[model samples]
Target: MAEDLVLDTAIRDWVLIPLSVVMVLIGILRYFVSKLMRSSPAPDAKMVKEGQVIIRARNLKSGANFIPPRSFRTRRLYYSNEENGLLHVPKGQGTNPQAQMFSDPNMAMDMMKKNLSMIIPQTLTFGFVNFFFSGFVAAKIPFPLTQRFRSMLQNGIDLSTVDVSYVSSRSWYFLNLFGLRGLFSLILGDENAIDDTQRMMQMGGLGFDASKSLSAEKDGLDIIQHEWALPRFEQRAESVLRKLVK
Candidate 1:
């Protein structure tokens, strides 16, 4: 019996302990890497001599999807006038390269593939860690206290920011064992989260109105000429300054 106990202890320390440590490390690394990728700045255009704008209608009619037309739409703003007390652009010359990307089926497919490739690995890595280490960490603690501690970790380190890449790992695990087992409902919930994040990021960082951008009238929205939102704003400011100087 003593010999058996000694062997069991050795196995626990050498095998189980090491495995547990490795798992925890992998999980943490996964989380940080995801954070890095998600937080990477969206492209900026100033370096490349570009401009960006989020179009707002001067007097968009009520209940209408304030957007531009498709075939007649032009990308770059090379026309100007006044209409109904606001700056009016009747017909414009030049075309926006960014705006043109959506109409190309091949380009759209390529973009989607690239995005999915970036998200999948980050998500899976996080999932693996959340599934394996979270439980292991919970083992030493009391039942009632485990959830509370886990919740603390999640809120403190997880969803408070934009890191939604590995949500299936952290958030879904808690949900599944915590009585949320309906697979269909869970999937729908994940989709909603993803959609929400995409919308929020586009609105806040890119100043993009996806709805308007997608409609029959696509030209109405201001074209983001160069890259990200910051440089676009900067470019506009510089243009205003130049006009003042001249």
Candidate 2:
């Protein structure tokens, strides 16, 4: 009788424990999957162009990263002869870069001093809050899943006549993710980076005009991709502007 009771207890443990573990695993997986599905950003050809600009900008490193501390930087934008039609133009390859600024150091210092109160805290708060929430949301989503979703969704969406509004909507997920990561330099006290970021924002909207000129009616996925890549594009545009200004 004792042997039979022992065997029965062992069987109950094997069945109940495994079933509980499986259910818990399933629930956890579902929560993660739901968050991921909600965070996918639509992508297309226009997005590809924006991504290329970002890559080029990173190559240039236009913002304060190139400046020395206790010195301020100023830049101007102009059209380029070699790379005709790109919105953010750089200086000609052979030009003397330093001859452009004359007696502006004092002015620059005054401007920097005046902006310290607003710029520093504004940058820090913006960087920290944006990074924290965006990072949390990003941590819950996966790019692999977003890419897969893009493939599936692309089939149903019209490729032509896509407007900026829809494109922006699709990219809202990505805006909530890496957009946060991009804000960290300021909260960590990188003034140069913040200066660079402000310059990029001040520049004209990232090539939306160029896109509109090239295509009268862009497709939905194309718009989503284009808008999604704006942060990177802005960075690239600043580099182009810096070269022209110098």
Candidate 3:
């Protein structure tokens, strides 16, 4: 805790630099590993047909108010009719659509693969770093860290009385895990490397909710209520003509 006790400057070259570089390298490697292992399901006839139907439905709903009420009704019935509709999808044959979405085999497998791609390398990296770099003080935070952060920031260092400013090599590695976005972008370009911060946020529920997205989309599609605006077109035109005459 003493201001007089400064960490040797060589620690930056030996510990901080190497650890940061290694963490970055590992991330790049992880990206390729994920890409190689990632076997995204190809869009087949059923999926493509369903997707096109959904797109058409969405376009129709967006522009529904611009068309005549009768036209909108005809298109809605044509698309939503259960017996012959594109996505008619009979009611009560299964559980709620949202529940069905939850039990979907494809969704389950995709979730598993995504989680595995995230978990496996992180586990291996942390295990390897902790085993090799446990006790050494690796770097210092530019600012103060509270007691709450002590356990998280100081992973391997055991000095109970030491200042919380100094962090262990493993913790430093973890810091670089989320901190190297700019460096990665430079090395791997914009879309090449995954942004770990976004990934972490998603894992923590602060990011996009793909799990409920299908249900949300289905709900949106179900309630595409539109008020016909074209019905007022003639009235508005006549009013404009009267105003011009005056």
Give the number of the best model, judged by TM-score: 3
TM-score of each: 0.28, 0.19, 0.69
Error of 1 at 149 (Å): 9.8
Candidate 2, position 127, lDDT: 55
Once fitted onto the true fold, the runs of candidate 2 whose alpha carbons sit more than 4 angstroms away are: 1-27, 35-42, 62-85, 89-246
Per-residue C-alpha lDDT of model 3 across residues 53-114, encoded as one tens digit per residue: 77887788688899877788888777766577655655444234445446677756766787
lDDT pick, better of 1 and 2: 1
Residue 138, candidate 2: C-alpha displacement in angstroms: 32
Order the numbered candidates by TM-score, best leading. 3, 1, 2
TM-score of 2: 0.19
- List residue ranges in candidate 3 displaced over 4 A: 42-44, 92-115, 181-246
Q: Candidate 1: misplaced stretches above 4 Å? A: 1-80, 83-87, 91-102, 130-134, 137-200, 203-246
Candidate 3: lDDT of 72? 84
The sequence of per-residue lDDT tens digits that candidate 2 reaches over residues 1-246 is 011111234433543333334334433343344334332334447557745654443333333234332221111111111245233323343223233222446434534543454355446534543443221111112222333344222322344332212222223323332343334334433432444356456333322333332222212112221123456777999999999999
